[model samples]
Structure formats: C-alpha cells, structure tokens
Target: MFFFMAKKDRDYFLSFIAIVFLILHLHVSANEEADRIISLPGQPKVAFQQFSGYVTVNEVAGRALFYWLTEAVQQPSSKPLVVWLNGGPGCSSVAYGASEEIGPFRISKTTSGLYLNKFSWNKLANLLFLETPAGVGFSYSNRSSDLFDTGDIRTAKDSLQFLIRWLDRFPRYKNREVYLTGESYAGHYVPQLARQIVNYNANTNHKINFKGFMVGNAVTDNYYDNLGTVNYWWSHAMISDKTYKQLMSTCDFQRQKESNECESLYYYAMDQEFGNIDQYNIYAPPCNNSDGSSATRHNMRLPHRPHSAVQLYSGYDPCTEKYAEIYYNRPDVQKALHANISGHIPYKWTACSETLNRNWNDTDSSILPIYRELIAAGLRIWVFSGDVDAVVPVTATRYSLAQLKLDTTISWYPWYVKKQVGGWTEVYKGLTFATVRGAGHEVPVFKPRAAFQLFSSFLQGKPLPKS
Candidate 1:
C-alpha cells in the first residue's frame, strides 16, 4: 500500500467528480421544470409557474390524459396538491375547472382574452385540472373503440395510471399531500379514485399521501337525486303541482328502466320544470340565445356559442363558455399550451365532446356505498352543494347523505365569509356537508369568493368560519 499519486492526476480526478455532480444537478432541475408554460395568450402577469401537457396512461391504445397545473401563489414547494375534475361523466375539466371555475383566470367576455380571478383556489394549493378518461377535451385514445368504452371503473383505473405517470414526469409532487376533488358525476369519480389509491398503497409501499376528497353538487344516489330534484322543483315553484304529483306517483327512480307511463309523466314533468331556464341554476336567468334543449345539452353539456349572448346577474356572463371555446381552439393557444401534439385526436377541440357523451357507457345507480367505505376508512370527506343548483340541488345531497346515517358532530349552522353569511354547514363523525349560498351547479363560476373560502377550509381540514 505504498503507492504515491501524482498531484496533477489527483486534481484531474477531483475536477471530473465536480463536473459530473453539476451535470446531474442541472438534469434534475431541467426535469423539474419540464412543460413549464412560458406565456399564454391574453394572460396577465403572474409570479407562479404554470404547466400543461399530456401523460400517457395506456401505451397499446396510445391513450393519454391532459392536465393543466398552476403552482401556489407564493411558496409552491410547501403547498399540497389539489386535483380538480369536472363531471359530466364526459365533460372537460380543463374547459370548466381550469377556464371557467377555480383556475387562476377566467375567459374574458370579448372571447379574445383572459382576466385574473382574485379568488382562485391556486392561492392556497397547487391546482391541477385534468381532462380525463381518454375521450374528453384534448385527451384521446388511438384505438377508436376506447372512446366509447369508458365508465366509472375504466375512468378510475386510467386516472390512477395518469397520476402515477404524471408524478413520474414531475417527481417533485410525488410525495406531497394529494386531494382529489370534483363535482356532479365526479360524485362517482373522486371516491372511486381515492379507493384505488388506498388499494395501491396497501399493495405497494409507494404511497401517494392521499389526504381526502371533496365534491360539490355531486350525484351520489340516483333515487334520492331524482326524488329531491322533484321536491326542490315543487317547493321552489318551478313545476306545476300536477306535474310534481305525477312524478312522485309514477316514477321509480331506483329501477334501471322505467315503465312507459312513468317515462311519459317524467318527461312531461321535466318539460314544465326546466322550460327555457338554465337548470344548473334555477333562479339564474337562462342564456339568452340558448334554446334550452334537452337535459344532455342544458344541464350536463359544456357552455358553447349560441346565436346570441346574454348578461346574467352581476358581472357574470353566460357567454363565458363561448369565449373559452374560442380562446382554447386557437392554433396559437394550443401551441402555447402544448396541446394536440400527438395527433391522437382527429378533430378540433370542443368544450364538451358530444361524441364522448353519447359513447359514455357506465351509469352507476349510487356512489353512496363508496362514501360509506371511505368515511369508515377515516378519510376526510366533505360534500358541498350550491343551494341554487336545480340539477343536483342541496335537497338532493341532503337526502343522499341521510342514507349514510353518520352521527352528527355539529348541528346545522351558518358559515360566514367576508362578514357575510356564505352558506350553511354541518359536521358528521367523519364527513362534512355544506352549501354555497346563491351559487349554481358550478359553484366557483357563480360565487368564486365563497367557493374559495370553502376550498381553503377543506384543504386545511378546518371547519368553515361560523359567526
């Protein structure tokens, strides 16, 4: 062991080691910042970083899910990850959740620009909006059959895969506390995905650190949803007494198929109940140019251009959806957002794909059982409703929660935001129920400040402010 090393040779070895370490560090930094959005058309100046791209979930089918992520306003590294999904069972989360709802900006009325939402949920957490299940929005599958072959089970599985692959791409968020949140038919989506995450953690040591899930104006049970909808319509005087009576006497919501007599009465009742109004928010004025067509077009469909646009109460514009469509479909905007690069999709992007909606294959009768299981598993579950939403009204959610029969931890009480009564809230042993006053089915789009308040509380696992 008496070898003498030359000084130049030793120095050369040390320098090589330093260069190698520096290159490795740079590589990690580059990967961390991959897919960063340098700028977007009509976007205002902001300090937080934004990202958008696709994560392939299935290779054989060339299936991918698209996501738009906004880091927290200040210290993004310390914030939790919150993923938002919009439910039509076929709607676009990027269109609704990112553009029109709680995302950082709202599409401007002019259809050529955007404006910052002062109450964006990204202020509190890293917000991720996903266009899921391979057929909605910019997400697509190479196998054409994959478009129509989707349901709760397939959706959950693919979403889980998306999360896994997405984290691989941006590993910084791999260990962060994750919250799965959605609304409407996401009543089915959020719970199912959480269950899958739980199973995933149990089998492998790879934990996603899933904290909980929250849904607003969700569809938990068809029977209660239908019953409560009729009751809400009748109580609110949206339907005639005879129509309400007929709906109650003839319809059996629990059954998969209804009798001919029931269908006739149901259709008649719906005709009177909806008419030319926006069923999403019963009291809110209908979009002027909208013909108020079928349930698929009015209640579940994404906003699109009509012959003309109308103004709603306050600064809210009913034509925002049209603006969103115009803004996103721009060739330059797609390049900026890094969308449609793979050519898996054949046509231009739309807010909600009619093809996807028509092809959607699964409709579960109830997601209530999943709720019971998740609550028993000690997951933080919060379900909020926009009181004015006739489609999935507060009454409907109330009836569905009643089926759970969880012991009440806090009695019903008013919750406040900015010194005003925001809504009502109740706490159960493992779940919480809340309502957003004057909000619609898409609560954030109608009452953003209140929705932000609700969302901040949910992420912090804190009760809504009671005053």
Candidate 2:
C-alpha cells in the first residue's frame, strides 16, 4: 500500500513506453556517417590511449555520436567487452566511469588529473566508455540546432551503433562476450541498450554477440527509485521535516509539476546536509532539477564541475561538507592535487545536457516489454544496485522486476568474497538482482572489491555470487 503503483496505471505507464519507442523507431533515425573520432585535449604522460569515435545508429542518423574507449595496460584474454555508462539520463561514462569509478585512474588531489588506481576494472575486461546521445562530453554537433532534444531512444540507438563500430574497431571482439555495465541512469541505459542489441540481432542475419549486462545502483523505476532514495535518506537522517513536507506538499515528480514552495523547501533541505558519501554516488533527490524553474536547468547541483571537484580533493579540502562525502569531498582526493592538467585533460563533470534531456520522455515504460523480449532471446540479464544508493536503490529494481514473475526463484541470497560480505543476491526465473553493500548510485567507487566481483560473476555467465 505504501508504494502504490496501481495495476491499471502501471499498465498504461508501460503502454506509453512502448508507444514512444515504436513511434521513435518508426520515424527512421537519420543515417549519415558523421565524424566519429575526437582527440584527448591535453596530452599527458601516455599511460594509455583514449579515443573518441562514432557508432552509426539509426536513431541518430547522419551523426556518428561520441564514445570514449579505454583499453587495458595489459591484454584481456579475448574476454568480454564491457561497455560502461554513467547515469544522468545524460551523464558521461568517460568522466565518471573512466576517472572516478572503475577505470584505471583516479584523479590526483592537487591537480584535476589522473592517477592510476591499483584496482581499476579494466584489469578484468576491455572497457569502453561512452559520451552517448551526442553533445555529451566532447561529442558535439556543428548545428547547435542538432542538440535540440535528446531522449532515451537516441541514446539506445547510439549505443547499439557504437557497439557495431566498436566491434569493427576491434574486429577480434566481434563475437566476444559483450557485457554492458553502468551505474545510476545506466540502469535504464543498459536495459534499453541490451534490448536494442537483441533487437538488432533479431532483425539481421549477421548476429551480434551479447553476453550479459550489469547495473550498479541503477535507476530502474522512476516512481520507486525516486521515492525510495528520498525515504532512505530520511531514515538515515539526511533531510529534516521541513524538507520532507516541502516535497510532500509541492512537487509531483511523476506528473512533472512542482510548486514554488516545494522547490524552495527542497533546496532548503539540501542545504541542511548530504548523507554519507560513497565512492560511487549519484546526486540525491534523483536530480529532479533542484536547480531551476524548468527541468532543462534543474540538474546543475554539483558543488562544482568535475575538475574543480577533483582539485578540491588534492588538498583534502572537503569542499562541500554539506553534502555526503561521496556527493562532496572533504580534504579532497589525494592525487588530484599534483596531476598535470593544464593543456588538455578534458574535464567533463556533468554528462549530458539538460537542454537535450528534457525533450524526450525520460520515464520509459517500454522496459518491461523490452525485458520480456530480451529474456525470451536467451541473453543473460542481471540488474544490481548499491544498497546505499538512493538514486537507483535496490527497492526500485525489486518493484519493477516483481512484474516479471520469472519461472521461479532459482536461488536467492547474499554473496561474499574472501570471506568478506559483498552484498545480497536474488535470482528469480532467469533474472538476477544483486545489491552491493555500502555502495551508492555508483557501486564501483565505494566498493571496488564487490564491484569487481559483480563484474566478474556476470561476465562468466555464472549465477551472481552468494554471501
């Protein structure tokens, strides 16, 4: 009763998702080969190479789209190609995934630069980072007009196309076990991307290989993830009564409408204090544009841009103590202080432009059908979350997946590694959901060990690890 999404309403919600997708696909995405590759701005000590290129997807026809590819220092055993996406509906995978989360390097404290992390995920698989939906990160369109409105449709299209081109780039991995992994918004991104991959496979004779997918603290269902994140924070003492009531009284997130009082009250609450920081975290309140009048400018809540964030860490500055440690830093990160980033270490803090995000229906109802379709296709599907992550908490996923009613609960429980608890795991029918402990929206940042475990487990197509 508390989390009431009526069956009729849910059904309608889902139907809308399918219709939007059907309409978008029917339109026929523009298909011209636009420029794909872009250079890394400032050339630093070349520990590795990061290249930008386009994956020709039908959704964004005539545009190559931008994607960042990070290779491992050592060779991966023709393993799986794990594509990483950071959520924001428009977040950039390169900045968050490559720099902050599991990518090989973490920015130094003194400089807004990169330092090698001993436990980056690249050690396990070939990592591909994307600045999807065009206009994210360095990917751009000459026609500012082109940046008009971006939606999940174009995003999935770009991802599918990028996969094709990526395979072309590394033809060897053409049939490799391809796993899509991401955090927060990627919950939505990964499912859709996986669905598209399946769709592509079904449509064409040239079958593209797909192994599985992993989502960490992903935004699975808007209604639940949004509400659960807030309630979780309150239970943890992040927000006070004034703010909670403000939210209750003023905003209707589902309806996409808000009152001035609600907006004012919410910001006042945020002004109180952010919750516990996690290595992998998303902006709390699920970023409903606490920043402005329109959703267009609503997401700029970062204490500062990405570089400034890392820079603050250099001195261990603890820049925004008001927010959680993960959301903000105190005393900053240790290495970001000394990295050489003057010329071109292109720093993209917030991925995806709000201007673009607002155009399409972010709340995609098509996923249920998409999920049903994918499972029917034999593609391994797994959705995992960081328990602490309010953004895409496990609860939202649980609610969404409940509808699937798989054949049976294969085996559901917790997973552990080296005798250390990673998180809880649940398998029903064929779908699996694992909740990583002490992790936020971004699972890898807070719990690298668990993150790697989750990655490795799914990559092997084995049952998710058990406690």
C-alpha local distance difference test of each model: 0.81, 0.58
lDDT tens string, model 1, 233-332?
A: 8998888988888878988878645678877775665565567766777676665545644222333211111111212456677766677778888877
Candidate 1: regions farther than 4 A off: 1-34, 290-296, 299-312
TM-score of each: 0.91, 0.70
In Å, residue 212's CA in model 1 sits off its true spot by: 0.6
What's the residue-level lDDT of 69 in candidate 2?
58
List, residue by residue over 357-406, the lDDT tens digit for candidate 2: 54444457426677787788777878887776544456667766777778
What is candidate 2's local distance difference test score? 0.58
Model 1, residue 314: displacement in angstroms? 2.4
Highest lDDT against the true fold, candidate = 1
Candidate 1 at 161: error in angstroms? 0.7
Any idea how many clashes model 2 has? Answer: 41
Candidate 2 versus the native: TM-score? 0.70
